[model samples]
Target: MFKPLKGLLVLDFSQFLSGPSAALRLADMGARVIKVERPDGGDLCRRLYISNLELDGDSTLFHSINRNKESVSTNLKDPADLQFVRKLIEKADVMIQNFRPGVMEKIGLSYVTVKEWNPLLVYGTITGYGQNGPWKNKPGQDLLVQSLSGLAWLNGDADQPPVPFGLAVADMMAGGHLVQGILACLVRRGITGQGGLVEVSLLESTLDFQFEVLTTHLNDGGKAPQRSSVNSAHAYLGAPYGIYETKDGFISLAMGSVTELGELLACGPLAAYADPASWFAERDEIKAHLRDHLKQGNTAHWLGILEPAGYWCSDVLTWQRLLEHEAFKELQMTQHVKRDNGAELITTRCPIRIDGEIYQSAIGSPKIGEHNDKIKQEFGGVVRE
Candidate 1:
């Protein structure tokens, strides 16, 4: 496959998720990402297990996020190792770091310092809040940032306490935002022949993530979002915008007309509230009615009716059902990745397609410092072998 970023090099100084995820995207697009790790333990994520699951002597979490990348161990505190890493940075096209503010500056790898050595390198930084805020020095964990940014309040029912997403959405979103900034910097560098620093915070990214609802909350008075008391799916959406229980399973409905949905489902009670304004105002009552009405049919039965009529609805699927479905099977999302140590794993590949072909790398993540020799020889850095 044609790789757009084939010749580009990225030196990833980030650990855990946020910064490493940005490097993962660059690697997915075919950049050579060399993870800079400490000689002692490398990324902390190696042992940061989300569950009891383990793969290749490290947590599956580490392998999944760091896949298709190289690793070069270095101790930034040591002068020799720091100079060695500086050599790699002098040649890298992009550098990503997620350490708390002033950590990189403590070392000599700050954007200002690095820009002196390499004028065209893009420096990307991810932080908890931002440079000067009181929260700047705090930990950038996903859940904490979500709570601080008011994202947790958007999920679950109205009466329930603030509920965070099941996944690390804050970190992932910050990674995406960093990638956008880095990509923009790269484009600017192409024209101006100068590098720039791109900074994003989990707080800012989480805020941007909910720009739609937050904007509504800001403009439509300082009122907090009121989630549906019954079958809540969206904080802003009205009735029929939630998961409904089926006889055997569950189905979700996106934004659509209440009257049209009522007419299609033959629910007389729902059809009575025909006013569009009531969709937002009477969301709970309508949702309660929908919850009762939908329970009479199975998921497939409702999909058969709703899908044919062009109402935005789908059967809520579990991971087991999703993997077994032909629609997912046709996408060919999964790949078998093997490491040089005879370790193998089944994981999803990059979601991007180029020239009608899905670009997937069979290369699994490296063992700590696995590529040290190869990268050191190729880059002609310090005498460290």
Candidate 2:
């Protein structure tokens, strides 16, 4: 369906979330991605489990990120395997790896070495930190990066200890950044007829994710962010910008005039906050009043009053309620894919839409080295004895 990367080929040598996720995006755009893995055990993410769930003996996490891609197992340390991989590199339009700084160089597959084989190849790399930093060798785990980047300090109530995001935000952000860099380089390659190196680190990407608030801290006398003492959703935002409990459920509110919100909710104490500066200065008192007032009515009752008035508000929803809602159904965001062995998985389709057409595939992730025979036949590469 008008896939822009229809004829491109990608060799993904990365394991786990960050690098594999980048390859997944490329595959979604119609690139032919071949995962180059070790013959034994393959990607370590195959065993990285969440909730102890497994599909076809691989972690569901691995299956979710590796779909619509092929697999070719090779041991880079072996001369024969390394030679065959070099041949593949010579033919690939793009290559991705997430090994720590010097791992690829030691394996003789570094960008400096591979660029000589395929001049127009886009080489992408993801590291825990930038290559020259002291943190470069540190593990690039999601939580560690989150904690190190000060992102954890921005969540939860101010009284509570630092809270990390429930999801692997750092890995996902780095992956997305890598994709953006790779795509931009591809565009430039079309003009210059030369490939380029794209590098992203989990620490750097996570820092970029906090650019807005961090920018504020940098410019505003270097003052530390002051999170709301109650219902703190954002550290730098003012009153009425957090979720509140209702009689039956919860609702969230965004930025708006405090007096207008107080008038609408009939919370008279809020009239004192008519001056906008008081919203931030006395956010706890303002939010405490909102908290007590909102809990008196059901979530729907509060929504009914605020929605018609054009205030930015919503009823907080759980996954069950959201999936059942017609709005979610209209998006058609989920799809079913199956492995060759008939193992089926229900997962999300690509979020990107090209020319108003949603991209989807029925192919699931492959077994380690699943495409070895087919690849050897198609590419005519033989291992030197």
- Candidate with the greatest lDDT versus the true structure: 2
Q: Which residue ranges in model 2 land beyond 4 Å of their true spot?
A: 382-385
**Which residue window of length 10 is worst by lDDT in model 1?**
376-385
Instruction: Give a tens-digit lDDT track for model 2, residues 59-116.
Output: 9999999999999988899987888898899999999999999999999999999999
Listed in order, each prediction's TM-score against the native is 0.97, 0.99
**TM-score of candidate 2 on Cα atoms, chains taken together:** 0.99
With candidate 1 superimposed using the best TM-score fit, by how many Å does residue 322's alpha carbon deviate from the native?
A: 0.3
Model 1 TM-score, all chains together: 0.97
Per-residue lDDT over 222-335 for candidate 1, one digit per residue giving the tens place of the 0 to 100 score: 998888888888888877788889899999999999999999988889877889999989998898888898889888888999899999998888999999999999999999
User: How does model 2 fare in lDDT?
Assistant: 0.94
